[model samples]
Target: MALTTDRPITTAGLAAQRQPERNRNVGRTLRRLPGYAAVALLLVVVTYPLIWLFLGSFKTQDEFLNNPTTSLPDSFTNFANYSQAWSSVATYLQNSLLTVLPSLALIIAFGTAAGFALEVLVWKGRQTTLMLFLAGIMIPGQMILLPLFTVYFQLHLTGTLWPLIITYTATGLPLTVFMMATYFRAIPKSVFEAATMDGASIIRSFISIGFPMMRNSVLTIALVQFFFLWNDLLIALTFTTDDAQRTVQVGLLNFTGQFGVVEYGPTFAAICINVLLILAIYIFLNQRVMRGLAAGAVKG
Candidate 1:
């Protein structure tokens, strides 16, 4: 005789037991449907314009003008517009790099140093100095533009790139300093104390230890300032009168004329170039940016 349980083993019984679990899985998926749909819709809304821009970049002037904006180009091999746009914007792009790179370097170096001294060093008036930087953040850039131009004019620096660099550095520094100081404050003081006992100078400790740990914060600041300087039109236009000193943002204006004439193909190509570069950089550094933001959030 075989040993048997009180209930008989049957497919119907097994199916009956599993039915509630299957229903629960279905309910969970149904509950998440709205969020999935929302994300998909948002992605399309953001990506559709970029798709249009890329397609338009390949079109000739005649094709772009005659065809519907939604239509694809007849040829993707057209490089004429890109060649033309590059030639037109090359000088401006060079000037932009010159202005942005130097400005960013100064901002990072000075901001980090100042923040370290304020937050890490035990010095008199440290709090007062931090407060001053905080106050600088509230001052409107527009209010000081006329005065800055006047001073630049007086110093005979109006035509050069120096004014743009100096203005960008100055305007960018306060926020950088504030954020850096905030980051530095969260670091334990005993770490520096131990290094001091080991015969390490403040500069040596900062270089070897302090600054290295700030990689995420520094990257975050760099990206923020990079985008700002890259996209800025007002400051670039105001400070630069000569075409030689104009940045890429201002250079884009050259594609338009007084009579409403536009070079659609080359304009789209130039814009696509900028968009693609920015996207590439963002994608590359996006992980670091996310980590930096998460660190800041948790640290606070």
Candidate 2:
């Protein structure tokens, strides 16, 4: 025999039972709306400049003057901006690679190792040394440039690629040490102890255990350092001389002649290409960083 509860509870009874679900849906909908709106606004703000640059690359000075906001070609005339920009841009790009890549490698290698060692290794005055390293972040950029320039002169390294490489690498060390110290410290001490218990020496444990674990943090910071060095014009300008050593920034400045012969087409074209490349790199790495964080949080 089938049985029913009470006097066959009304629709209001069912609604009361599902009240939590309804409240959850309302709360989720309200919270989700603002988050999505924020993301949309941020996208628009970030996109406008890039869109402007890209569209401007296609526009002739006449068209630009006629109507600036229009993105597409007025009549689809052939574009030579990219070609001219490439011809002038590649040389400077190569110079940047030479200076930036080596410096990047040096900074990561030294900084990561230093960070791992400072946090993990048994040593006297470790706290004091770490504190001193952390203090470097407080130093002003310009106050040191003159002394750095003098040192560069004394070493006969000025007007050469080495100066840029060495200076950027060394200058980056402070921040690298600071960040890596924090990340390394976040690692569990027990793991290091286990490695030590396995008869691993100082260098062996660091190489076999510490480095692999810190790979994400290292890559994240290396990219950050690369961006800083890549975009730097002040140090590049101060250290290098002659067209051979001039970076893309100095090269782009050539467009601004004494007269009004601005090469906006080539400049914008070059800039657009770089912006696109940087975007690609950022997207790819950000994905990796996200994945690392998720995996890490889960593992922890």
Candidate No. with top lDDT = 1
| C-alpha RMSD in Å of predicted model 2 compared with the true structure | 3.7
Candidate 2: stretches off by over 4 Å: 1-34, 69-71, 75-77, 257-260, 291-300
| Cα shift from native, residue 227, model 2 (Å) | 1.4
Which number leads on TM-score?
A: 1
Clashes of 2: 0
lDDT of 1 at 7: 81
User: What tens-digit string does per-residue lDDT give for candidate 1 at 163-201?
Assistant: 999999999999999888888887899999999999999
Candidate 2, residue 127: how far the Cα is off, in Å: 0.8
Q: Residues 205-275, candidate 2: write the lDDT tens digits.
A: 88898889888878888878888888888888888777888777666666542485886766788887777
User: Candidate 1: RMSD over Cα atoms?
Assistant: 2.0
Cα lDDT for residue 181, model 1? Answer: 87
Error of 2 at 151 (Å): 2.0
